[model samples]
Target chain A: MRPDTPKVLFGIAGQLIMQIMPEVRTPIAGQTLTLSAALLSMVAQEFDRAASRLVEENRSVRTLLAASRDTVSEQALRSRIDAETADMHEHDFHVSALQAVNDRLRSLLIDVHAAVETTPGEAAAGLNERIWDELKESTRRRHLASGLA
Target chain B: MEPELAKYLTSKIPGSTGMAISNVFRIPGGASRETWMFDAAWEENGESRSEAFILRKDPPASLLASQRELEYAFYRAFEDSGVPVPRMRWIENGSEALGAPFFIMERILGCDSNTTRIQDAEYAPVRDAIARRMYEIMAEIHDFDWKGTAIEEVLAPPAPGECWKRELDHWEQVINENELSPQPIARAAIRWLRANPPPPPDRVTVVHADYRVGNFLYTVKGIHGVVDWEMAHLGDPLEDLAWSFMEAWEWTRDGRKGGIIWAEDAIRIYEEASGTKVNREALHWWDVFGSVKGQAIWLTGARSFQDGKTAELMMPFTSYWLINFQDEIMLRAMGRGA
Candidate 1:
């Protein structure tokens, strides 16, 4: 099959579906087709960015973790951040590895979040604000056009 | 004999020849009972007559302590009291034919239960007023004295400070058993709840645990009735009030309390009609607790769907649709990292 054959076939099938189940006569069927189309659209988007988004986000979190070395007072956490900072970014980093890192960072982010919530001082406040901004921005990058960002 | 049901219905409804029941269908409303909506016919006096009614059968998953008979009694107590409740016709506890205890009642007449479309302009113009009326009626329910009704007889007497504990423990146990996801937010809220417990209830009253905009029937005139009394029990009345106003049911996203009426307006109407003041802090406490309870439900739905325990429409939809929203609610409620 040609590279674009799947797209052409999906479009043809979708048109047939809509013609047989117009919204006025069959709203549920029509809605189902529309949702299927949307799901396929998401599949296409994900196909293009599946790895890139993970790579970008993993790098961002690693960057933030390194940046935290100056702010975190706990020697253990600081040393972990320092080691993670020294780690080289690898192209061979698989999707699962990136996601695994993401999960660790996210869980650690919660700890960082809870710690900052209890702590005071401008450094803690500023660090907390930066973490919030990163979380917000990360959500923005992942926002679906169909949803509220 | 679905013998208990046949005997119970026959004795109460005086009839004659051809008074035989068949094709009994016990539908699932298992949290409350095995609800059977079926047909009955008989010769009353001399004429042949028929009617469609509901049967409530007690099951193992009694979410609360209230008996099926008490629900029937409450329904009977309020049949013609302008409460828009179903006409509860019969109650049968002896299990013989159906294999479980059950009751029969006149099924409510309305569209399928849904609040998702209540906000559409087709239903919206009357939606606000209907919501207001529903809140007012709920206040009337909150004020309905257990002392004067059969509710107190079936429900346990309230303790001085155990209402919150009872509710929290029940819902938390459900989550512990049924949760499909790691609920960091609910876990944190449970901790906060235990640490800063709400004060003892001003009054213990019957709580409809699943009260919300969706579990009701409304028309252009106003709310016709509040249905689905499956999770009814005794608790702090404010728990009912807060559950009704929980934020997850905010289908309209216009600050409409439970997608029905505005929070302030609903509370005002409730207070005016019930003659009972709602404490803002306690209600807020119940509101967060309501979110936790809702998470438990969504969690249960996911577990049931996965375990093939129920084939209901909502089981998968709860996990696919509302689990994330429940997390979002937990985030907002706890005022953590949002």
Candidate 2:
């Protein structure tokens, strides 16, 4: 154990109680505390995974954006998509870079989603399923620890 | 309120009364109104009187919420209609009276607000019957008309298919504007929602957008009242049923829908009471929609906490407690989570 471990635990209890006790001790406080501790623990997990999750999402989005160039009929969106695909830099990927790409990809997702809604076919269906696939993965990535039962 | 303000309110309660405001606590956001509970007493007309009264003030933030007067008027209009709501005695909208704004109502007595009670041993035996009764009340509410009534002018117009669209756009817009991190789950849910629009509702009815466990007041015998009408709106009534039946609210984390009844049984009970058929597919749509809506609200609360908009209980509580489960709800809606 670290030399300051006792102090750290003491600090945690002191800080949490000092900050949250007034509101925490209201209706169903125990439930609130248990849930809060679980969430804080999960946030710690998500903290470890955040950059990776964003990196993966950004990569997935880039792949979809590239694929969209073949089928998305809107010339402007297609040209933009191709340009984004051509500028791919997987080297030295950071959380901020992933976040930037994630934003662009999400914007593209909205367009792609709307586009597929208008045009109907097996191809569109496949793309829709791909979007859903990403969505499911994203949810899995974002899952947090919570009190059950 | 300041002690002076509390004393002033004590003065306005009709007769000369000296009462103490014991543990006058402020809960989290009322969203639609400022809700505070305090003890009040005085000579009512002539004789001695004492009782707990809750003050619901209309804050500057809640301007476009469900009309305060109208919300009160609904129950007042339906006083004999059997939907159990607190007797809303007075609604004061003008801010001049009490710094912000407020309403007063008789506080319903002796009820616990724990969200876990439905499955608790004390209440388990009666949960089924209470569940049925709650659904029955909701069905009756769905059957009631808000148009040919007193406060029709106050609520937003009930659009046909645009109801879902309007609500979705607003909530999605909120997520877009305030989200601290990427919200891919809500984003996916929105796409799915618009892509597969549910059948146009049978008719728009009063929707209690936040109908779930922990929001309602109940006894071991049955539900006495369903509280927290902050998100009440004019929309498909089935939205309430679906929101109530959402699996995340299964406090036991089992198949028990709201720790009250099974999903099928909930629908059956509501249908039996309202004489309306349950559209399974549409209800399924609303169930998914409920998760999205739930996430949006929880996210908003988290944003409030992060932004320091209000250090209120609910904001942090939701940010901590409900946000993760919201993702789980998303996974379930996407056919991923259990």
Candidate 3:
């Protein structure tokens, strides 16, 4: 909290890559060191955005599930979506809780997307587009700041 | 460890009065197996005999869980073929020998497979040649006749039309079994892949399921030996080509497939060598499928790590590095790039 988590991690990763890695004599040990540094870099990136990404994705998936209910003809799927969408607010803002809710919503979203693809109509088409849109947005939410892709 | 391995080698190597294994060291970057390099010296017929050997021992859990026998057959099938592979010596499935099943091969010395070094300006003069030969060897791999070979013993070839479904279903099951969290993007891509399947391959060929730049050993002259046959199978040749073109292997992130040649150049070379036309639509389908397969591999490693099955740091490292990035690649392949 003093120097900030990301900054501290970046500092340690820089040391690992630049200083400690060169001193590692064994091939496997050095490779592990390099990967450790890389892991630090990725963890640093996630540390700043983990909670926000989880919350954003949970909300986005829940919204899609709610909209998909009317378009899907599957009775069980619609009821499940309705039940999941009923609680829009995050009573527990903890990342774990949000992720738990996120998993349920996204799982239901998959079911919704599958069900809607079977029916053909204006409403189903609209729901399909919405599902794709949310899927696209979901990638953006998880995109790393690192130039990996 | 060397003493134990040398003792094990004594039983495997015949007519050797004495044996000594020295300089035993673990080679890095073998995520699917624990690879080691050492020099084995022995007295055969009262004469000094030495060989540099590579040991590919199975880990408790790996990014892949391929059968060692199947992998051995694949490496054996390509020996003396156009494709260069290390000469496989022996394969032991019994774990009692070295704490796990392993196979030893004659190491192809004085070559590097480091991806970053191959992409550097120092190797610029040979990069084009290497890239060209890469595709040429791929063509050879696809052209190899496996009908009466060791390959047939390990793998059953899928029908042309069923290739996509088999691979898609396999990776989808992998994702289903290993994912710790829901993957909406992957799920959507999987749906699209199901909707638009590719045409049957012209012929089923040997698919080096992880064929790419880093998998092959090279000098500035050219590639020497292609390694890592853990995922080798009989399937669509296009799957291997598309996998080589995956964005993740674009180590430089400069749009070059395998950080060497452009996609068009790779395709042209492969087409010319293999005498087959690469359908763009089909390649696109495999490209997306490649991402799904890639993510499944990483997720498998991640789950292995999280479940306390193994403590290999590379597991979480790859998951952190590739999982989300692979999702973005899937989106792009699905024409939903954001």
Q: How do all the candidates rank in terms of TM-score, highest first?
A: 3, 2, 1
By DockQ, the better pick of 2 and 3 is 3
Worst 10 residues of 1 chain A by lDDT: A140-149
In candidate 2, position A1 carries an lDDT of: 54
How accurate locally is residue B248 in candidate 1, as Cα lDDT from 0 to 100? 74
Model 3 lDDT tens row, B1-338: 77877787788778885788899999888889999999999988888998999999999897887889999999999999989999999998898888888999999999999888897787999999999999999999999999999999878889999989998999899999999998877887888899999999989989999999899999988999999999898889999999999999998888999889999999999999999999999999999999999999999999999999899999998888789889888888888776
Chain B of candidate 1 achieves a TM-score of: 0.83
lDDT of each: 0.67, 0.70, 0.89
Candidate 1, residue B205: the lDDT equals 69
Task: Rate residue A43 of model 2 by lDDT.
Answer: 52
Q: Candidate 1: misplaced stretches above 4 Å?
A: A1-149, B1-37, B55-82, B89-103, B110-113, B116-128, B148-150, B157-161, B191-199, B258-260, B334-338
CAPRI docking class of candidate 2: acceptable
